[model samples]
Target: MILEKKVPELWTHLLMVAFAAVCVYVFLPSLLIIYKIIVTVILIVILSIDLVLIIRKKVNYLKLTRLALVNLSILLIIVCLIFYTTNFLVLTDANSLKSVLGGSTLMGKLLFLLICFLQPIVLPLPEAVTIPAGSAVLGSFNAAYLGYSGTISGIATMFLLARIGG
Candidate 1:
């Protein structure tokens, strides 16, 4: 009797697994690098748990997943645009208005870093913009530090949002 009830849920589980496998495959090189493997595994586990909850009808996983997917899609598009613009700037004039800003004063560099740090959490700017601007103005080490700070800030914001929302 219980087996009869669970059979359909089992099928749903299988389908979700297959769909997730396809998503992982399609995202392979980006997701499969040695450094990223752990993160990828964690994400897969989270998704799997969410799928189980969805199948059990214990949660509104669909709405959550849909929101995540939409946000991810937007981020991807912004990332691509940033990459394209960066490449274009590097390949084309290379001495345009942005390049001029790249050679800003020390105060300017600090200001730019602060903006980059805030933008991710507050404004949602493309990281590529912040990175190149940092590299050009602050050099590689400072740029890396600024980027790390921005990521930390973003993570903190996400945590706060999750805590509040949950």
Candidate 2:
């Protein structure tokens, strides 16, 4: 009986991960309409299955509900930030993005560091964006140092969160 319950919950968890990957990898980066339609279809199917499972009470609905809420909230926040930031800053290119990072200002360095740190764990900003920008503004060695530092710390924070939550 316990195993029966656990298997469905495990399937649900796997489905959620797949849904998130499609959203992050397929839908978020691309602007093509075809990709958007595909992502929408994939997401709809995944959500439908999860909803059916919850409706049938085959898995723990409460946990799945909380997970969905949190995931949606984070994705919404990231999307809003992307649109708002792009409009406000008018970042037309990678060079423009680097300029916004302030080149060598202390606040800019801190902000860059913060972005790098938050990016791996929370923000969906690609490492390609962060690392190359940092290298351009802060020099190759310094950028590499900061990038590694932030990445390591971010991974450590993920481990800490999982340990505490689990």
Candidate 3:
């Protein structure tokens, strides 16, 4: 009985970790596309198995529904971002992106900052792409400062979102 109780708890934590890992993996540029896809698939499979085991072991329906909704929302957002980027964005090079972002105007800077700000929360852009471009356009110091602020704000927004969801 004790072991049974512990198993569910263990699976719950594992599921959370797997989900978090997958989310982190998706945005951070890995060495290769094939490796990324393979690892993500394994993590997702683990997550799905853990979810099934936890559900089978008996959990509250209300909590389950809330969890499902939050997961679904995140998946939807990621899918939409992928679709938008693939269909609308043409420039894949960092230098071109830097030129566009660095229009050498106040409005351009603000837009660049905004992109950095949303990168974590909504945009599925790798930091590699944004940071280098920002550095070239805004210089190292200004780019770092703006990027740091945007990242922090994005993190805070995610925290608020999790709180609201719960």
Q: Residue 5: error of model 1 in Å?
A: 74
lDDT of 2: 0.68
Ranking by lDDT: 2, 3, 1
Error of 3 at 118 (Å): 0.6
Which candidate number would show the highest lDDT if scored against the true structure? 2
lDDT of each: 0.57, 0.68, 0.66
Q: Candidate 3 on 1-166: residue-level lDDT in tens?
A: 5346656555565656555455545553433677556656655665565566556764343255346435744764585568557643643468777778766667757867887788788877788988888888888898898888998898888889989986
Model 1 bad stretches (over 4 Å): 1-104
Which of the two candidates, 2 or 3, achieves a greater lDDT against the reference?
2
Against the true structure, what is each candidate's TM-score? 0.34, 0.45, 0.46
Instruction: State the TM-score for model 1.
Output: 0.34
